[model samples]
Target: MLEEFVSLGKWWLPNNPEVVVPGKLSFSPVSGAKLELIGSFYSSQFEEIGQVEGIELPSDFVSIEENFNLTSRVRIDFIKPEEIIILGLLDNNEEITLYRCSGRMKSFEFVKNRPNLLFNIACIFRKIHFQDEQNIKLKSISVQYSHLEQWIGKSGIQAVILEEENKIWISYQPPSNIHLTKIGSLDLNITFSPINVNPFDFYLGATYYKANIEQKTYLTIQNPGNQPLDECINLLISFRDLLSFAMTKPTSVISVTGKTDVIQTKPIEQANGSITLKEELRETQVIIMFGLWNSEKNSETKLSPNEMLFLFSDVENSLGEVFETWIKKRETYESVFDLLMTTMYTPSLYLHYGLINIIQALEAYHTSKYEGIYQDKKVYEKGLYKKFLEVLKDFPSESVDNENGISDEFRNALKGKLKSQTRFTLETRLKEILSEIFCLLPPNFIGSLEARGLFARKASETRNALTHHDKEKRKKAGKGQELVQLFHTLTVILQICLLRELNIPDDSIKILVERNRVYQKEWRPSSN
Candidate 1:
């Protein structure tokens, strides 16, 4: 009979339901079973002996409930039986009835031809007391929250919580005083219910809900509203409570919405991914919205909706403007900018790549300047001969011919042809090429050659170590601090190169270099 009911119930109930019905039995087979329960009932027995002889009859009473007894049962249907079926009866409507009953199977018997199995059930029942619900609603609230130690800019964070009957709604507004007016991309970290309970359980809307304990999730919206800049954006989230231990398990839902007066509002898709912000020539404004559902586990628990908004704007600096100018003058400037932005964002990992790219950019510029010079056969031959003569200067006159297997004429021709190649060492080449690019030599160099020389040497060594796996040299690099310093110095060098390419005045370039050098000491690699 129980098996028939269990099969019928399985077909009648849905696989997963919002609410579970009462008197549902979920059964699983086991190998052996043991059940035990103890109960005590108390009563008093009194006997009066009537005696005419005695003036007063003494009443005698005995306590009948003082004895304690325990009942335990274990049953083995067969020797090494195939299986033992365990049954559990659920009182799903305990919230309405204010009562709970639990039972376990103690013994089982299987008959050869009988369709139903016989079993013994022991159950315990208890009544529950109802708790009074406390409701709290706040019209406006201010909450400051950040992924890092403090908020980035000087914007104030504000939030609000609204509760009507069993529904909860929260909204957080970020600071509006953004430094920029446009945004390219953004990332936000939202924490829901910083405490233990899952706030999404109370979500009360049409959206799907996935249960997460102490839920902390991140939602990123890109190209928001599909406009250049989103003027208004709204996000809705819903949560349903599966466990109904208190207050009938109210569903909580919230929506985060904000508007900006910026132009070119675009429609964006909602996504659950991360976006990396890059340095841009123009300022880009971004807004991050955070929604939180605050609730405690108690009859008089205070449920509050809290939210915070963060506004950030990426503004251009002098160095960035110089890069922008380079983009117009040089065809390869975009590649250089990509490397620079990558290094700026993730310095510890790609700073070396940035350094190498700067060198390449300078080389490209140099090659382009002398491209026409090399195209002229007369000038090319003259330059080649000049380089051959310079190479000959390193050897004694008598031994020059015997230095290699080639004759004097062939050797000279070969040296001349290869004169335009990279002849100087990396460090020497950096200093020499930088000197030419910046038009600074003796007394008016943007930075001291001695200081630049040191930087060049360290940069060369670090690059070599990173490329060739020089353990000793890498150990001397000292935990990337020197690498970061070298990266900053190289950045300044590139900035000077860009400024010179734009026909900027030498004095202005020097002033910019000096100003940026101060920031070098405090600049550290960031992964933001």
Candidate 2:
């Protein structure tokens, strides 16, 4: 899925020496075809014997020859006058092209003297494999045969079924024991009674989430217990299933808890509203944990509002210049990064880079806060909306220029890229990629301008913090309680932003927001 070959003659011999009755004779090819030429080449011979009347026949017989060499063709004859025949081999030249005979005859037409030759010449064909297709493997083989005019009507192909309790299984076996694994497909059908198992008991566990505005996601997995699971097992979770609740009518808060080993997650907060993740699992689970964010969705970081206003103005003012430069190198990602770097200040970038503990707390607060609104919509919705607007109004302001010599043009360009977020802003383009930072929920989450703006501001801050650190700051950054606080705040913030999209519960959302606030109390408040 075979090509060129020559044909040979067929014959029937009756009691003659040159053509002995019911005997086999091997013939050699004179000129064409390739042969491995195993051992020596000579004419083939065979003898016929009558079977004892009551002896049962064996399915297969073993031949003890080293190998047979054929020059061109061979002939076989049977003493019995039975018209039935089964062709097992070509009995002629070997194949060189892409067409092959399946060792079965098309019609029962017997050429008076030529019994071997057929109307259509046979060739071999080989199939081509593609990169994407799965390589199919043979699992089992079977064959069967019956005498003509059996009681079950026709003698060919009968099904075998195995039954146990309410279950059934089917298979087929060939008449001979030649181990013909290449006989192709045989169907099997089975049904069985259900086996009971606990829904909470699992061999493995993991979680993930996404946000509506960001491209990144957060993910975590439990340490499988004593028994190790096969690595081939995959983690699969459908966004449609996870976000099904988000798309549905709002509900009350729900909560669950376990050892830290049972869950994997990033810090809750960052400059951006929150993060989200989606999971893939090898098996399905009915019960799962989801954390809702409680940080005020509309709540603003200290400098968030002013920062947004400044960047928004700077972007509008420099739009024409930025777009012009962007168009010149529109094909590259650097053009976009350069644009963002222009408008975002060191503090903004610093927060965006996610280095400071306060930045993480900010992210967590927003994530949990917004998530709580969805969880306890009736109680929190109006207040959260008010806070969100207040935060936006008081957002941070960027310095007109930096002494470090990072240009205003570059800052604006960078912010432009980050804000617009085309496919060009993928992690592949950025140096310290933030795939987990900006988690977008699968089904798409919506929020007020303040909620959205806070998320965007955090993203800018996280980026700045990551890229703008000097040697002195780097030296002072230690693996202490601050680092843990940063991660927790980051997770809480990201989780809230993600959960809002998921319509997570108020209790779960508040847990993360409160967690972040606890950590943020230790750090200096951001400059507005």
TM-scores, all candidates, are 0.30, 0.19
Model 2 reaches what TM-score against the true structure?
0.19
lDDT of 1 by residue, 1-528 (tens): 001112111101122233222233322111111222111010111122232342332345332223311111111121121111122222333211111222333233223211222222221111211121110111111112212111123323333445555544443333332121222332222223234444665675435454332222222222333432122122211111111101112222222222222223344444756554443332222222222222111222232211111111111223233323443554545554444433433424555676666555544444444332323556755776566667665644445545544556765776655654534456665666666655432233335556666656666776677767888888644245756566555655665665566566676556445443334342222223
Positional deviation of 200 in candidate 1, in angstroms? Answer: 20
Give the true-structure RMSD of model 1. 27.8
Tell me the tens digit of each residue's lDDT in model 2 across 171-254.
222222111011012221111112343455554553324312211111112322311111101111111111111211111112
Candidate 1: stretches off by over 4 Å = 1-332, 342-358, 361-378, 386-419, 422-429, 432-447, 453-485, 495-528
| Cα shift from native, residue 294, model 1 (Å) | 35
Candidate 1, lDDT over the whole model: 0.35
lDDT of 2: 0.27
Give Cα-based local distance difference scores for all models: 0.35, 0.27
